[model samples]
Target: MAGQLSTNSTDHAHALARQVRKLRETRGWSREHLAIEAGISLSTLARLESQSVAQPGFFTVGAVAEALNVSLDDLFRSTRTNPGLWSAGYEGRDIDSFVASLLDHGIDMVADVRLTPISRKPGFSKSRLGEALSQAGIQYTHLRALGNPKDNRAPFWDGRVNVGQARFRDILRSAEAQSDLNRLTEQAVQSRVAVLCFEKDEERCHRKVVLDTVRERIVVEVQSLS
Candidate 1:
């Protein structure tokens, strides 16, 4: 019975870590801010969020829950069963908030599917975006082969999204794209990755099709963040 109880406590700690991190991010609070609000040291909060604490004290957990303005039961119940795949767009958000949203969703890697990753948006250009993600401890990979060709982009901006999507499907059939797709598939199996693009709407974005191809190779839970 003691061993079983220990296992349960460990599970609870993992759940609590996820819950606290999510709650903190939802409020746009940083670890330091949450630590100060909870009257705990930053290291303690970091350990909790990192699941390094296998059995955090009851009062400490309660303090964190209170700081996040959530009941302990509500926090525990928010634990997700799967990390899943996430999709995001930088349509109207600045770089900081965009990175924040990715972190909020627990994404450790981002797959950029733009053919020419030169964004007019300030920080979204390939190098800048990659640097920002790295600073946030997230890996960024650009899969140029997954990008829709320029000839195929007009239909997405115009009314014939299906036409654009069909053209992109053809692009995916090529050897280079297939190679990248395989790489992305392998990465998805190992990490929480997000497919990123510029369009706010998933249906219009080629990322939708990119995700479709990924789904063909693996069973993944997909969620789009605005």
Candidate 2:
């Protein structure tokens, strides 16, 4: 009987861990964000999600539940699983339309891959965009390391080289770029993540290069929202 009880307890812990992770992902929250929202130490939330604690304390659980805006009973309920990856550009989109497109496609997070997160368009600057996404309940993260250097991209724009033959793939072979690509893939595995840029067309954007590089490492479904 004791052995059976122990097994059940372990199963419950695992289930709780999965549920917590799913809930966090659904809201596009990083562990740090959730920890802050829950008013708990980051390490405690990490341990709880990792199932290092066989049984979390009531107050700890209550804090998490409150932060997630769900009751204890609701926390245990299963959620719809995340789909693979999606991509979007803000070429002609206003902030409202841009966010609406993301919502239409069930995107939980926006991964900005611009080297310089500035734009002539209103509300597209890094700080403003982040605030807008937060208001829309979508998480926004900027991965500048994945952006193509202007020097490298300039030749293609000047017609010295065809855009199709720009050798952008070579950039992905760099150690730093690979590391950022891996990080983006890990985030996508946890939630519905989209690569964001300003080009209205995927073919014209460096984000496609980043997306293709990621695909070589992991299986992903690609969608373009321009």
Candidate 3:
């Protein structure tokens, strides 16, 4: 009967919606928490997930991607294939899809390496970012020692360095810094690890320094979680 066919179609659609919702929740994200990250209204996520609306707009998918810190490719990745979380880029600040990618890779920790750790961007800032990650099933920790100094290693700047570039090697060569990087890599080998910073541009940020140090010790695949 036509009624039976329609019911089957609705069931299938709801099943997919449930999959998407469960994936995001696995990271522990609330609809509101995800909404803020994606730069969308809470009502939008509520409607999408609750209604199981088929073919949600591209902008929504993109926003969800940004919130989750993953890519569109990552969002739809079948769990039957990839069993872990991975790094991904954003399109429309899609936190949902981004979280979906994290779910894909099984990312559990975020090691932040920002020189300033401040941000004009919403989710990139320290506290907000940490909370968002926590809501998304990722642990957050800031490693200030691994970050670049405002003086760029000037001795007199923070008075921690004896001279210019003196502190460079300290930050570059410290046990704490090394420990952080090593810990990150260990996570990558065992789980997924994301390096956090304010700037979207990886090269401009001190995350590179931590990444370089990470590379020296372990075979971590560097990724821009922008």
Give the candidate number with the greatest lDDT.
1
| Candidate 2: clashing pairs of residues | none
Clashing pairs in 1: none
lDDT of 2 by residue, 99-205 (tens): 87776565666888888899999999999988776555456777767887787776545554445335667766778777777778876666667798887777667
lDDT of each: 0.79, 0.73, 0.55
* TM-score top scorer: 1
Worst 10 residues of 1 by lDDT: 1-10
> Of 2 and 3, which scores higher on TM-score?
2
lDDT of 1 by residue, 1-226 (tens): 0001112334455556766876787799999999999999999888887767778888899899899888888776665434457888889989999988886676766888888888889899988998887656566788888988888888999989999998889989999999988877876665567888899998888999999889998998789874
The residue ranges of model 2 lying beyond 4 angstroms of the native Cα positions read: 1-79, 155-166
What ranking of all candidate models by lDDT puts the best one first?
1, 2, 3
Quote each prediction's TM-score. 0.66, 0.62, 0.50
Candidate 3 displacement at residue 91 in angstroms = 12
Best first by TM-score, ranked: 1, 2, 3
Candidate 1 whole-model C-alpha lDDT, 0 to 1:
0.79
